[model samples]
Target: MTFTQNRLSSERLAQVSAGSRFSYNRTQQAIGIVHFGIGAFHRAHQAWYTDRAMDAGDRNWATCGVSLRSKNVADQLTPQDGLYTVAERSERGTHLCVVGAVQEVLVHPRDCNAIIERLSSPDTHIASFTVTEKGYCRSADGSLDPDRAGAGSIYDYLTRGLALRKERGLSGLTLLSCDNLADNGRQLERLLKAYCAENDAQLGEWIATNCTFPCTMVDRIVPATTDADRTDIMEILQVQDEAAVVTESFTQWVIEDKFAGPRPAWEQVGAEIVSDVAPYETAKLRMLNGAHSALAYLGLKAGYTFVHEAIGDPALRSLVEQLMREEAAPTVATADGQSLPSYAEALIARFANPALQHKLIQIGMDGSQKIPQRWLETLEANRTAGRQCPAIIAAMKAWFAHLRGDNGPVEDPMADRLTEIASRTSDAQCAVALFGEGGMMPRIWQVSEEKLQALFS
Candidate 1:
């Protein structure tokens, strides 16, 4: 390619420096679209989609990456003039692609002023977040979480920024939440509204009257990039890059058609912009994410090191496929997509991909936060039907076992829950309460504690 990494890095301020192959600077040409929680998944998926949007020249929807905490955004993105790399891989082969949609980057507290200014700017019309499922600060029924006290860091920032924007007579921006949580956008609105209500009633009213939070469903298996991925890209593409990313071949984004400013023609570039994201969200959460959780827990318990290892194991892999059949397929409700079984089969094939190297621990890191979204609902669905979910039930059993810390010496990092459960080992009832019953599967609280103890204990 004519635009080489050396040529690009010499001229630009690199954002995140991971030696990834897709780092370059086409960012100066675009406008800001404020983004929070700028992680690997955002770079590999949303940024990639925006990069595709940028290809047409009329759309100037650039991204601004802001960190909530010490989210390690600068550790990767700032060295080579805001340049980084993205490495996309699947079973077929690999490709090196550069994403420069994130035009500006900032870390909070230090760059708090900059973040607020960007949010208040009229030109900055879209505010999207991938702050994680736990980050939403929402309630269980998909509304704003009422539990938190007034004006936390994120909420404070939004409150102040929106007030400033209103003082300048600017309209509200589109707030898109890309977390795996259900009704992510609406949930964000709840949080935003709650914050605004406590701090400024006018701002709250303005947000209710003006802001548009579009519900979205995004799916992709974007793995964290590593040093080995750098070598692989260098060997294959014959290019040296400093922030390459790695992800599976499959990617899907379903956005609601609500934008305050001009958005990229993502629909033109293969993204589905739908009216109701519910069905899409359900399918992805239940089938794809559910299977993923099942694999991570079950795979680890079976002594497998990585996701590929689990898929490679005939017994474990068969067990996962069975879960797909019994639990995942029936609950999936996407109205205009392929059948759930077909999707699960395809996902299984992707999971078996040796090159992607997705780690079980990486997938299993936030099991406490992930399982409710992925598996619990389906488990309940199976219960309602009175069906035999030996494999899924067994996986849940293994997950609880994992949480209980029976298998290892190091106390699996994912076993913090197990440690808590272990504390109540003497009192089975208290222990059972930890899992919301049987000390396992806290998300499925409706299920009887006695039954969970019978199954898991």
Candidate 2:
């Protein structure tokens, strides 16, 4: 039997494993959080945490997931009543738990106006975002990109929704960003304010006075669900779940203690509510995300698909460790009393988790948007301090090589620009051209052309 609303019941659940189904009353859950980008990561991280909180009596945090672009997630989960299984894998074993966090879903074009209406409602106290870096539609300096706005991006949609909210005189909501960008909440606020100011000054003033944007850092290794994962779910529960999410048995969320209104008691369930999320955000970006990108490009070049396969290779793992320890850590401040050494050790072990087949190419996507925070800022800081980062230079070279049809087909907003840079010869001269004066990366390109060429050489 397949899992669906009609098929799920107390009697049916009794026949299944204890941890495989939610024991609580699903009927009582109501939507409070309106989440953009209903993807695997959200389902595995935020939704999971919210579901646990609801199960533990904090029932006001049920999510109404909205799919901004793709209808695939809605298509898969809506039929199941937004109830999907999360298979947590680790070296010890695997455990399955059904997540009932998202009680309703809205797919764009199907219910575009409804999404806006729901967001404008006073019940929706949080408009959370996990729409990736490019989804913000911002330029290098964090302002709203005129070109992206012209194309009717998320920024346009958000501005329109806020205008509607202002017209309705609804209370302001906290806009939370769970993406892997530095000061993500601040960036979203900047873009939204820029869009609103250009469209309606009065609305912009309302947002500035009413709304709050809180920066957050989320950590988990959630791989895209494969057919094998679905098969395993069927074998375990005698039911097919198309929307099952697979991930490692670890989770962390660091959130700034800033909100426009009341929020979930997420701190009750291991979330670190801090006054400032800058140090934690910077540490994860430079160490974990930067290392992941390094592994993705270098791993792809070495003909490996999974992260474990890349880390299992002693040489590649050593290079990654060296990059983390010798290069990336120096630029990132310590966080939560955890030294870089222990953090790097834990990351290395997490990456080598064979149970979760996290793909390399997935992490390597949208390098143009991802690279600025992951490596560029750190590279600039290191160079300004009169330090050289050979490992970062190597990773940058891998990205350039990856862009030029080396790893696979490129998927980036700046794909054409990357192709243009990659068109030059595959030598240190090309490196010089790409990172030198008048190239794409101005921050890291601050070094002399000779020095850039030398690093690549």
Candidate 3:
């Protein structure tokens, strides 16, 4: 069948492999989740888990995805009847499954009332988010920026939705944050409350009294879906799935056990429901994400395009291992029975997975917003302990070089300012200029001139 004529949909489910088709009745499942920032990561990770739960007989937890800015995802999934494929690729092979957990996709502002109506429904038990760090519109101090909390922001939509729920006398929902932020749930609660407090004090009181924000630590390596991925998915499913996502087989989600309402049996599908997600989040952020950023900048500088290729280089591989082990690992206080060494080694193996084709450039984007949590915190923690981090320093140098367009164009929130700083300042003084007082980063590094020269050399 041709691409246009054989689009994947409810009617076309029988055409795909039996195992890839939804095991449960998709039509009978109700939408219990209103997810913001329905991007590739959300699809390949959270929605995949939700699909697994549904397959295991947990219904009424299907997701309604909200695209805050773009209509691209809505355009892709709506045409396919919200049935998209997730191709889990690895060195072994590819495993394709059609995720039916996302029942609908709504573009915000245009469908704002529909979204609010969904949120106010008693059946909707959760409002989750995968909006990247910048989507929070946080100031440097990590508080919500009131100026950016205008109409059409997630904060605006959520506040309005929650208020409607309150007015409708519906039970409060759990606001789950699946992003890579530190103490994600608490941070989300704090920011949302701040927004509510400023705009509607009564709504803030209602939220404080009723809603729950459960912190989550979500880990997955989902690369941006390319045309090649779409073609491969088409071959496997025998139907066109434009919204198909490609990811590594490995996935982990650690959630704080607190929730305002009933939720899916995500634990049965391998999600960890724990009291504290801090240790897990810190470990993943420092080890996996820090190593990833290092690989991206260093790998690009070394002329490597993909993660597996970069880790295949001995020097880069050793550097990443040391960054995770010697630098990042020490700062992470692991949970009981959690092994940092094993996690780091697993990350290396995952990065070396040839079939995933995770791009260096994709990881490298938004470095200015990402580096603080991924690398700088590790650096600061090591500094506080009086331990040296040559590996992190090397990575930082690579990042600084990256800012100067050593590899290619910078794709960061602070791109223009950072590039300008890199252009005007000397190598020895650049770090100071960027991390010093009035700089982007929180803490300044105190590296000597000799070491700085050695870095460039």
On lDDT, the leading prediction is 3
CA lDDT of every candidate = 0.71, 0.83, 0.87
Provide the clashing-pair count of each candidate structure: 33, 0, 0
Winner on TM-score between 2 and 3 is: 3
TM-score of each: 0.87, 0.94, 0.96
- Best-to-worst lDDT order: 3, 2, 1
Q: How far off is residue 19 in model 3, in Å? A: 0.9
Mind giving the per-residue lDDT tens digits that candidate 1 earns over 87-145? 76766777666566767678877888888998998778788888776566544334455
lDDT of 2: 0.83
Arrange candidates, best TM-score first: 3, 2, 1
Model 2 per-residue lDDT tens digits across residues 1-457 = 5444333333344556766766667777667899988899999999888888787788767798888778899888877778788899999988988888888889877887888887887777898989999888766555667878753466656667777888888888899999998999898888887887777788889889889999999999998999988888767876667788999888999999999998888988888899999888888998999999999998998899999999998988988998889888898877668688888999999999999989999999998888888888888888888887877777888887898889768998778877777866675776776567766653443678888777777
Q: What is the lDDT of residue 74 in candidate 2?
A: 82
Q: Residue 425 in candidate 2 has what lDDT? A: 64
lDDT of 3 by residue, 1-457 (tens): 5777999998998888878766899999999999999999999999999999999999899999999889999999998889999999987889999999999999977898998888888889999999898788886656787877788888888888898889989888899999888888998899988887778999999998889998889999998898998998887778998899999999999999999989999999999999999999999999999999999988998999999999999999999999999999999888999999899889989999988888999999988778888987887788789887888778878787888888778887668988999878766577766665555555534444455456444
Stretches > 4 Å off in candidate 1: 1-28, 138-153, 235-240, 405-418, 426-431, 435-445
